[model samples]
Target: MEKIIKEAIYIQSPTYIGSYKEEDCIFLLKDISHLVTEKDDKEREEDINDGVHYSQMLPFEDTPSDEYMNIFYESLKENAMKVAVNTLRICEQILKNKGNDVILVSLARGGTPVGVLAKRYIKYKYNIDCPHYSLSIIRDKGLDENALIYIINKHKSTNIQFIDAWTGKGVVNHTLEKACREFNMKYEVDIDSGLAVLSDVGRCAKIYGTREDFLIPSACLNSTGSGLISRTFLDDKIISKHDFHGAKYYSNWKDIDCSNYFVDYISELFEKIDTKSGDKYTDINIKTAREDLIDIQKRFGVDSIRKIKAGIGETTRVLLRKIPYKILVSDINNPNVKYVLLLAKDRGIPIEIYKDMNYLCCALVTFAE
Candidate 1:
């Protein structure tokens, strides 16, 4: 497929739903709120497992309660320093490997906040105003080539570094790798597919801040935490060849959107923590993690590995977006998953304690009926 050379529209903060400043990052996504048909979580999950692509529909995102918001704040307070340290480490590594002029292309939704923090770190530490943009990359549909072409034309392809908040089962990494290879072959340019993240619990990415599957508070909420933007959506009926992948801006959620608050809270701690002092390279047992995933599949009779979501971040996502069958936690008392516990309890989902698990927690999706 030849690369489409259409210029997709890019939106900045305030003009769009995100709370970040215009200079922080530009979103390469169309507002498709009017086109999206929001479905109940159970209905959406069933449709997805029945072979319907999730990108065809949106899950109804409820407004989090004050109590839930309190937990998010608590988690932020507890893990702010850790997040700040890792953000700096990831940014430093990017500069060292990709150079000062590198463009930070964060995978939409989850990666947006991390990209903003990274951009802030680079500016504060190196005084480099590197361009940052958030674009969509669906699981099976591949990346929005139009968005990639737009960015490549505006910036050097060699300097692009993909960013995300964390790795789940490394599915996105695989999707990104395959897409980048195809894009490079067709366009005759190399865009590195190695994803940079704050947490690499899946032990899949080559560049990461830590291998610990701790709570990243941003994962606690949906659009409210991610600049009030829906997860990237793509449907042939709604999205055109030239348009960027679609996303719905949660305009009504603006009053409670903590997107800016979460980033700024962590960014403030950047100066206090010494990113240079921590051990950037830690021993990560990818084999054990992979083995555990297989074991979970066998034990739970999960038909597809995609139904088994591992790690704190992934587990939270399953509870939030999918119809969770059950939640497996290494330690129920662990503060890292306080929000996860609350979510599971709220949904009346079954909880199991897996003491010998590789990741802190995991969530199993209900089989389609």
Candidate 2:
């Protein structure tokens, strides 16, 4: 298919909702894959504790069980529209507050969908076609220089807002700030990484649609939830001096395509949102989330802060990819928590339930390194 936008914008492949021909000018956001595979949980804790980077390993590709999938679909049906509506409401607020002059830079892979939704939201609601670009931002490594250049030269935008799907432990939030600072120092471009997201369970970023970290339905599935694009990689073989970081499209997963379903489900909810008036969850903040991490670090006596991953998505990630040390859940009764618990039990990892967590019930991967 031809590219979605008329300009020189590029779309990557393997996006969750749809696929583009290999020769298409735009790249699909679906090519980034999970490095941590299902079996890694056995050694996840030790490796992370021992200074192994979490990005180096692949998470297990455990297909959700039939019952678990049913719950995901049920949640999609029950709350997808609500989430979408609220998301649109948030987008409307952001556009009014920030104006259509700023650039929308999505943190590639995860933030691409939200960026696209925000783009669509702007065009549909205000009749303004804002430019949207998904850029690669690897934790620790920094944002892709070539991608930033491509965007800056094309639109000449100085004011940019970075985006992601949701916040987890606020690691990426900090990572983005650091990356932007280095980029500005090197290239003389002033880009602020103050991020916007669908949810801010970590309470870190200034702009977001929701503060609750319950279950984003999108978190339950991988590429299928976003555009079928794999995660971005900055490795030598795939990237070069002039070219942007590249990824492969999982052209094979068309059989179980859920990309459009996820996009449209949220887009349709735009009508239900009041746009002008809605209850914003502004009271919840990131300080508590950070404090929780500090407590976990103190309790576990781990040296590195990165080892203490939290939230459902991060915890689910621990079970799927890392060799989990243990899982501290918010509620054993929560259905979403059940699968994580099952995965933990199956792996023989310990699990403890606690009800104190605000967005997520529990935390995971307490490294005793």
Q: Model 1: per-residue lDDT, tens digit, 159-255?
A: 6899999987777888999999998887777788999999987777868888888889898788998888888898888987767888998887788
Native-to-model Cα distance after best TM-score fit, residue 38 in candidate 1, in Å: 1.2
lDDT of each candidate versus the true structure:
0.82, 0.63
lDDT of 2 by residue, 209-253 (tens): 777665666666665655555555555543446556655455567
Off by over 4 Å in 2: 1-68, 275-279, 301-303, 320-325, 331-350, 366-369
Roughly what TM-score does model 1 have, to 2 decimal places?
0.90
Residue 333 in candidate 2, Cα distance off native in Å = 5.5
User: Could you tell me the lDDT of residue 197 within candidate 2?
Assistant: 81
Candidate 1: 10-residue stretch with minimal lDDT: 6-15
Model 2, CA-based lDDT: 0.63
Question: What TM-score fits each model?
Answer: 0.90, 0.78
